[model samples]
Target: TVPGIGPVYTAGIVAEIGDISRFKNHNALAKFAGLTWRQHQSSKFSAEDIPLTRSGNYYLRYYLIEAA
Candidate 1:
């Protein structure tokens, strides 16, 4: 198990992410957990303080954040 995460959180995360094979990699898993930063770019400008996309499985995100 993870250092800070307990059994319940681990189970919740696993349950929310039914099939691990569906994701291509860790990045894909992060995206599914809504833990990725949003893109903020234009013609020649890119914002430095972009927020999270906040899209995807809500329960997974909640479990991950709480565990952290």
Candidate 2:
């Protein structure tokens, strides 16, 4: 069970909520992977270049990354 994945990769996967389908497209997925440019605005709201949405399953993400 141990010595499977590392931390960063695990965190990245966990940060992604649901299946890859949840992403509108490949670009979206890449964005979540922090492999693309950061979005600073959404319509009328402005956001920072922070990581994935914290509203996501944090425990899962943390554990994922930890395991990774």
Candidate 3:
């Protein structure tokens, strides 16, 4: 989810950020990969409280989804 990150580079990052727990929480880890929330809960988004900008680590998400 790193903005402007290339595939090769992303692979390296995933290799390095092995123990993601090194980050405090999901939000903190999400921010590291530039995957944070955006947008506001306006009248249109009232149904949804918070919306995250797809800025989370895609690799992490992918692996978890696959493993699950």
User: Which candidate has the highest TM-score of all?
Assistant: 1
Candidate 2: stretches off by over 4 Å: 1-17, 38-68
TM-score of each: 0.90, 0.31, 0.37
Clash pairs, candidate 2, are: 5-68, 6-68, 7-68, 11-65
Task: lDDT winner between 2 and 3, please give it.
Answer: 3
Model 1 over residues 1-68: C-alpha lDDT tens digits?
A: 57989889989999999989999999999998999998889999999998889898999999999988
Tens digits of lDDT, candidate 3, 1-68 = 64556676567667846887799987787676555657666666554466656666776655443433
Instruction: Report, for every candidate in turn, its global Cα lDDT versus the true structure.
Output: 0.93, 0.58, 0.63
Model 2: weakest 10-residue lDDT segment is 52-61
- RMSD for each of the candidates: 1.0, 7.3, 8.5
TM-score of 2: 0.31
Clashing pairs in 1: none
Ten contiguous residues with the weakest lDDT in model 3: 59-68
Better of 1 and 2 by TM-score: 1
The TM-score obtained by model 1 is 0.90
lDDT of 1 at 53: 90
